[model samples]
Target: MEKERREKEEREEKERREKEGREKKKGERARRKRNREWRKRERKKGERERKIKEKKRERKKGERERERRKRERRERRKKGEREDREKEERREKGEREERERRERERERKEKERCDEGERERDRERRKRERKRGERKKAEREREESEIGEREREKGERERKIKERKKGERERERRERERRKKKEERREKGEREERERRQRGERENGREREKQ
Candidate 1:
């Protein structure tokens, strides 16, 4: 009887030890699962930090490029301003040169006009002198011709007076010869008549004696 009871107690003790070992193994498996889940969460956090850093670096590079482009634009504007200044200076010089040329041309034209006026005045004086000399010669010729005509008229009047005096003397001599002839004829006729009358008286006395 005592050996059976001791054997039964040992068997019961062996079964309790086997059940405790199974419980320890299940606890160990649960711990291993929790560790694995924690490691996965840590890996996700690290990946997110790396992406944020890369985005910040890209933004910085874009800002630097924009600054460089602005500087280039400012340098180009300065060069254009210098070129414009040079062009303005050249235009002013050209305008001054044109003004000087126009002034010189006007002066030359004035000088030419003055010289031509002087030449015309000299020619007018020469023509006036020639006309005065021609008028003097014509007046002298007219005076000589009038004097010769007066002398010719005086000689013709003297010749006509001499012819009239000779005609008057011839007419007086013819009248005196006719008067002497008429007086001689009248005296002869009177003597003949007186002789005839005496004869007739002698005849009358003879008749008375006869009766």
Candidate 2:
């Protein structure tokens, strides 16, 4: 009977130990499962953080690229403006030279007219000297008086005709100058319109880029 009791106690102790071992195994399994789940959650969080950081980096890089392009465009525009200014200066110099040439031509024309008048006076003096002689002088003087009167009438007619022609020519020249001015103004307006349109197009492109 004591042996039976000892055997029963041993069996019960063995069973309890086995059950404790199973419970310990279950606890270990639960701990491992919890650790795996925590690791998975951490991994997902880390992945999400990495993606956000990557997106931020990409955005920063893009911004930097955009800024670089903007700076380059600005530099190009400044160079173009400087070139245009130089061209304008050259054009002004050419115009000044042209005006000076026209003024010199006008002076030469006036000097030629004065020289022609002096030559006509010298011819008239030589003719008067040749006629200054003898008994024919009285008859020559009478004829001279008649010729001078006829010449005076002719000169008055020529002067009147010249004044009328000059008036007409002056009006024509004024009209031509006015027409040229109007044409130049129209061309300038067209160019200004084109520049404005180009500016507007550039503004639209910039807005689209921003969008």
> In model 2, which regions exceed 4 Å deviation?
105-109, 112-211
Q: lDDT per residue, candidate 2, 1-211, as tens digits?
A: 9999999999999999978866775687578669767976996698689769967986897688669757875786577568757865786597568757865775676567768776577557545644553235466556756875687578658856976787689669868976996798689769966986786588557656744
- What TM-score does candidate 1 get on C-alpha atoms? 0.36
In candidate 2, residue 126 scores what lDDT?
45
lDDT of 2 at 136: 59
lDDT of 1 by residue, 1-211 (tens): 9999999998888777766765664576467557656765775576568658856865786577557656765665566556656755675577567656855775565567767676576457545654674575466545644654455455445534543454355335434543553454355435544653554455445544533
**What is the alpha-carbon lDDT for the whole of candidate 1?**
0.58
Worst 10 residues of 1 by lDDT: 162-171
Sliding window of 10 residues with minimal summed lDDT for model 2: 126-135
TM-score, predicted candidate 2 vs. hidden true structure: 0.49
